[model samples]
Target: MLDGSDLKSVRKNAGISQTDMANKLNCDRRTIINYEQGVCEPKSSQLFRWLDVC
Candidate 1:
């Protein structure tokens, strides 16, 4: 599973913002914030999409 810090790193390295990531994942910006803050984890499908995006 991707940790919050790892997700943040990947997102930063990919040169995307939380809004952009949320758009790519078809989710809310708050969802991206939650994931990056370690408040929640992504579902399998979401994870797949996130991996594809990053």
Candidate 2:
């Protein structure tokens, strides 16, 4: 299972920014921030979409 740090690492490694991730995920920057901050988890569909795009 991907956790907040793991997601952060992947995004940094891939050179993807939070705003860019939000655009790809069809959400807002705050949502991506929430994910990385562990305030919430993405929906399964959102997770898959994030993986697909990033």
Candidate 3:
């Protein structure tokens, strides 16, 4: 699982919207929201893509 702070920072650095990242990761916007809010963790494949996009 990724650290929530890191996730938020990366998203900001990449200038990516939650919805945009969700679209790129083939997930729902709620997924990104959850990750950012630290409500849930992303899966391995999603993590890889988040890193790639970030």
For residues 1-54, what per-residue lDDT tens digits would candidate 1 score against the true structure? Answer: 669888889889989999999999988999999998899999889888887898
* Cα shift from native, residue 53, model 2 (Å): 1.3
Error of 1 at 36 (Å): 0.7
lDDT, residue 42, candidate 2: 90
lDDT of each: 0.89, 0.86, 0.88
Can you tell me which runs of candidate 1 are displaced by over 4 Å? none
Residue pairs with backbone overlap in model 1? none
Model 3, 1-54: lDDT tens digits are 568878989998989998899899998999898998889898878888899998
Q: List the residue pairs that clash in candidate 3.
A: none
Model 2, position 43, has a per-residue lDDT of: 92
lDDT of 2 by residue, 1-54 (tens): 558877777888889999999988889999999998888999999988877776
